[model samples]
Target: MLSNQSEVPSLGPIQREQAWDQLQKNEFDMVVIGGGVVGAGTALDAATRGLKVALVEARDYASGTSSRSSKMFHGGLRYLEQFEFGLVREALHERELSLTRLAPHLVKPLRFLFPITHHLWERPYIAAGIFLYDRMGGAKSVPAQKHYTRAGALRLAPGLKRDSLVGGIQYYDTVVDDARHTMTVARTAAHYGAVVRTSTQVVGFLREADRVSGVRVRDVEDGRTAEVRAQVVVNATGVWTDEIQALSRVRGRFRVRSSKGVHIVVPRDRIVSDAAIILRTEKSVLFVIPWGSHWIIGTTDTDWNLDLGHPAATKADIDYILGHVNTVLVTPLTHEDIEGVYAGLRPLLAGESDETSKLSREHAVARVAPGLVAIAGGKYTTYRVMGQDAVDLAVDDIATRVASSVTERVPLVGADGYFALVNQTVSLGEQYGLHSYRIRHLLDRYGSLIGDVLSFADGTPELLAPITDAPSYLQVEAVYAAAAEGALHLDDILARRTRIAIEYAHRGVNCAEQVAALVAPILGWDAATADREVANYCARVAAEIESQQQPDDEAADALRAAAPESRPELLEPVPVSTPVQT
Candidate 1:
């Protein structure tokens, strides 16, 4: 139940190679499809319980909904309005555990102000909800909500329109770096003994008379096919749930619909706020969350049936968010203030509601076939519960008595000695020749493993300095990304590993080549391969920019699709097997 932070799963070249070898060699107890948060969490859960597990992803880790979230480990305050007490309570419990034990390095308490539009009824109504939220979940790790008068609220957030609010209520929630957290979860699973592979696509399902046997997948990196046999197969492919179900040819108990949510990032100075803001919108809700040096305002939920991989944010989508947020802001933001934009799709279980936003956020799990257990629909906050449910059901089908879930007690790698490492920042700064502030940043980002990144600068002192193009990060970060983190491609390093892709003004073009060069030796990339990687990444940025200018879905989809994929072999579509009743 304890994770040794010093010892990582080490998904470097040799480790990934060994993972494939193990995949082909053993008939695992469980084969988990998808590498999103839920899939990664499921792998950790099963492996910790002594099950032999293998997890496969068609793309990089957290390339889907897992990374594209609003970044809050909130209990969904709005869910109280919908009378979803159970969901909110469960999420609050998980949020508390994540903050205090599981991932203190990644998830930290964040304060938010709920601006009151109406004077009397709104304050009392919101207060009641906040009161219930603080006490539920069987614990409270954050501060309770506090009331603020209009003057007090203005002092906290001066950018808001004077007439926008009569008062405010401040409460706390946890914020996270979604992609890094997902990767750490998968790495923790690897530490506990799970064979995890990215760039591995499941083309078909292996079947036996009335049950699922295993999966047949292809390594997108090289043209290699692998037959991985397992006692149980878990379908956790997020938005592509039904697609995976079709491969098994079994009638699914439910269907999944794609709901696209888009977010835009702007400079921190644009919105003068000491805390994050949550406001009510026409259809759903609007959040102005605090991201390090930037402020993220977004999330318009609407039906999306476009290219699943790159969900493009149209001009209209951007305008819609601007229009709503502009209502409460004194200084109306135009397109000029925006720095970056990202879009992600949420998989909602098909229901009676015509509105995608109104569809249930609760998840459902069922045995689609004797050995195939499928789970769909849920928010990021409840992924652990969803994962636990999937593994528990798979255990039921295996018909073997095993230990119940104990992930609550397992701290992720880097979380064990985080507080002590934070305390050592001053000394660490003196030793590494970095400023105390810089040392604190690295400590929070890497926790106990900060030493691993610092070690890259041992011989080459130049690596200790910040990256010239992206001064926020060290050159050693890019080098260590390839050598330590499981970053194989240039896009993997820029986009997910460090978030340089969305955080920079040039969309990573300025630093893409430099980062590639830094990682070239570790990845064994030749001159030709490194150049190709940079070109592909630049093209992707250009296409994304052009797509954002388009007014509608079809135009944007075409431009986005025209961009080169990071892996050339992935450009070719794989054929799905015809449905045959076993």
Candidate 2:
């Protein structure tokens, strides 16, 4: 069956205002603060369960830690070493659900080869662990983990150092476009009649007697402050959980410590591997994840006590990741091989006196107050479970009885016909006059909603041209971001919607103007506004680059903090200059 080509449902201005008005009219069943994956998931869960829900985020959706991650949807392999069997099983189940049932289009299976250097004992031990991993909690979607000899392992990952491996084990996990998936979750919530708005900050909580009744929010987009009332208020703000708690004037039962993790992206050709590589490092595990035409290698987990908004990767952090990764490389990746760098803070429950690596990846939900519930400290894979738990707690205060969460059976917007579309990809590609690979990419990102994106190209074929700087992305995507994906700024389009910043060699500097120009008309930006958008994006990228060069968090945060504020007025119309007559 052909997919519906109607505008993919989103939060419109009327609906947003209606939600704000409803908060004044009557109390809602739930009000979720923070538009990260967890928050979005909570909103979806609550809304799907027949709760009157409203989700508010201080910045853009997933602007913080959610957007900046290792971009994997796997049960933590490292958690196995800590003997956290339950957490890994739960996360692995969720990973399978996302890949097969909920969001098959966004989440897909990825294979990783873990090379063993310690000969006999390591291979069997690791293989046994992977064998158990495959059998545990809904791992049936992908093939079982396979043990490989040195020669066999080299065939999958030729880039591994010849001397580094005695053997290897190939295992499967899943990866996602984190920012897009998070946004899609919020959109799905909107589709289910939840009021979702970004650039709207919950500045303070509205309390009744001793309970949180609602929140006082400031719309950063228009600079208007208003109150939103709900029977229950959920804090799903990840690293900012404590800050949200402080807003409610309630001391949280636990503290969340921010552990900064950084990742570097390079061209796919830099690493000659058909399968992703997982290498054990001195500090933590290193993953060379395959991402489209590029490879994402990352994650240095270090204590971060500086700025929470833009966590920067210091020179030391970069050196640490490179230092670990270089040890296992056939041809070492140097500074020149680095295309882009991004750092994110993991919200770990505080109480440990040990290193950040020792902190638990487990999540916690606490009823800190009568009407307030806070959920924090989990990896991205288990966000759905985290959201469900938070809502389950908040439901206690819900006046009228509501049905239990049906989100488990409720497929995300794109998952409905994703498998069928995948099966018929070749025919669809022929119909669109595009390559089957490109069609597959579109289907994976948009699923049944690919028709909406293709509709734009149908009217204006020029939109089908690939971006000048970031050739992997189409110009149609930038246009779609503004017109359909709720991208209000150039940063939203380039950084989150398209990932040009992390994939491009110049870090989206060259394409900023071109992208701004494409999105200008859709977002109502004039030449001056377009220029300002380009300038802000460029300055932000420059600041991030500068920040990464610093030695420590303090220096890095200070350098990165120099980024210009998001000013919509800068996108206002410019006066036309009069032409000179010769």
**Candidate that would win on lDDT:** 1
Evaluated at residue 208, the lDDT of candidate 2 is 88
Model 2 RMSD in angstroms: 7.6
Write down the TM-score for model 2. Answer: 0.94
- For candidate 1, write residues 217-326 as lDDT tens digits: 88888869889999899999888887787777877888889999999999899999999999999888999998889888889898988788888888999999999999
lDDT of 1 at 24: 91
For all the candidates, what are their Cα RMSDs to the real structure? Answer: 1.8, 7.6
lDDT of each candidate versus the true structure? 0.87, 0.84
lDDT of 1 at 12: 80
Residue pairs with colliding backbones in model 2 are 529-571
Residue-by-residue lDDT tens digits, candidate 2, 1-582:
112325446443445556567656666889999899999999999988888898988777788899999999998887888899999999998998888899999998998898889966898888878877887853588888788889998888888888889888888888899999999999888778788877778877888898889888877767778888889999898888776776677777888999999999988898888898888877788888999989998898889877787889888988888888888788888878889899999999988757899988899999998998999998899888998999999989998988887888877887787889899999998898878988898988888888878877877888888899888888888888777766778888888988989998789999999999887887778998888888888999999998888888889898887788674321211111223111
